[model samples]
Structures are given as C-alpha cells and as structure tokens.
Target: MKVDSVTEKAVKAVLDKFAESYARRDLKSAMSLIAPDDDVVIYGTGADEKRVGQEAIKTQFERDWAQIEDPGLEYNWISISAAGNVAWVAIDAVLKAKVDGQNLKFQSRITMVLEKRGDRWLIVQGHFSFPDQSQFFD
Candidate 1:
C-alpha cells in the first residue's frame, strides 16, 4: 500500500526524535520512543548483539551509555513505508562518541519497525549493522 504524506511525516518525526535523544544521552526520551511490550527487540551492530524485551533493552542501553560520552549521531533517512498501523523505516547512520577514553565511530545501516499505539508510534523492533558485502561475490 502507498504510504500517505501524513504517515510519512509522523514516522519521520519519531525517528528524528529518537536520534536526537540518543545524541543528547537522554535515555528516558530515547526509551519513550520504543514500545514497552515484551516482544520488542533490538539488534546492535555487533554480530551477536541482541536484546529482547523492554527490560533487556534498557539494561543494554545502560551499559552502553556508561561507556560512552559526548555522543554524536547522524541519520540519513532512506525510506519509510506504512501499511495500516505498522511502519518500517530505513536509515544510514553514523555514530561517534568517546568510549573508555578512546574515540569510537560506527557507520551502520539501520531498520526499525514501528507500530501505532493510539495516536503515537512506538518502535517494536530495531536492527543496526554494517552493509553486508557477502552477497556481491556469491
């Protein structure tokens, strides 16, 4: 189904808010964008990094925030599609921060699935990873 301009704008706003919250290290604001359901999932850039459920996600974020300082995030929105109450967003993002006294940077492709709850959109699943090149040589 074709996504209308209003749906696109609303989803974009939510995504932008999430990035802004993360850059500012405002955990509460960041978490507010995520669904509180037990089925919510988040996959980090690491090969095996996955967090399930709101509690697990919160714990992982706390640990990550403890090691990161002065965060900076840039999100290049690729696309957004919505069907009924669900929306998917794709973005290319760069994150930079000071971690353990060292500067760290990551460039990743991100996908987020959001479900409309009442009048607000809440992220239900999020995945972040570097572009995979394995398919090119296959």
Candidate 2:
C-alpha cells in the first residue's frame, strides 16, 4: 500500500479526534468518528471488550471514561497507509490517567481501518492492546 500524504493527514485527523474523545469523555463525538453501520467493530484490550455495532462500542467507551480520570495519551508514533478510499493506521502511545486516586501510565498499541465516506474518514474496524511486558517475553 502507498503512503499518501493527503490520505495520511486525513487519517491522522480522525485518529487525533478519537484520542481527544478519551480526554474529553465525549461519547457522542467518539461515536461520530466510527462508522454508523453494524459492521463497525472494536476489539479493546479488556478480556471482555469485543464490541460490535455502535451501541456496544458506545457502552465500552462510557465504561472506560467513567472508570478513569484525567484521561490522556502521548501519541509516540504512527504509521499510516492508504489504498483508494481505505486507510489503515498503527500507533504506539502511552496512556496516562488517574485511577483510584493514583496516577498511572501504560503503553498502548492501536490499529484501525478507516473508510472515507463522502468527506469524512470513519473508523470501521479497530483493535487496541497493551503490550505484554512479561519477563517471559524478555
């Protein structure tokens, strides 16, 4: 796949908006970035976070925002590629938040597939995971 600057910029904008939703805890805005179809799916890091459709994804976002405080992310790096109207992105990030009155940070990895519909690029499939830092892997 070719890495088109124009397409990459558009995809990056959508990804940025998604991260902003985490910070602002705005479910409506987040949902707007996702495709409004049943095919939309997101496999989150949680063991039970395989969400499909808009309602399921919305519930997951709400649960996460309610559980964490001062949510933010350090977008370390991103790789984007596009073909036609479809774009894919892989990102390395650090999640920062306050949980149970304790400040915490965790490394996160995100991959998403977006489809350009009209003038907007909407996320149609996404998978989010925290890298396993187990000694066994080392």
Residue-level error in angstroms, candidate 1, position 67:
1.9
For every model shown, the clashing-pair count is 0, 0
Please, what are the lDDT tens digits per residue for candidate 1 over residues 22-135? Answer: 888788998999999999999987665799998888887787777689777788656889999999988988888897788887777899999999999999999988777555
Tell me the lDDT of model 2 at 20: 93
Worst 10 residues of 2 by lDDT: 129-138
Q: What shift in Å separates residue 66 of candidate 1 from its native position after superposition?
A: 1.5
- Top candidate (TM-score): 2
Task: State TM-scores per candidate.
Answer: 0.87, 0.95
Off by over 4 Å in 2: 135-138
User: Which residue pairs show backbone clashes in model 1?
Assistant: none
Stretches of model 1 off by over 4 angstroms after superposition: 100-102, 132-138
- For model 1 the local lDDT of residue 45 reads 74
lDDT of 2 by residue, 9-70 (tens): 88989989988987899888999999999979999889999999999999998888888999
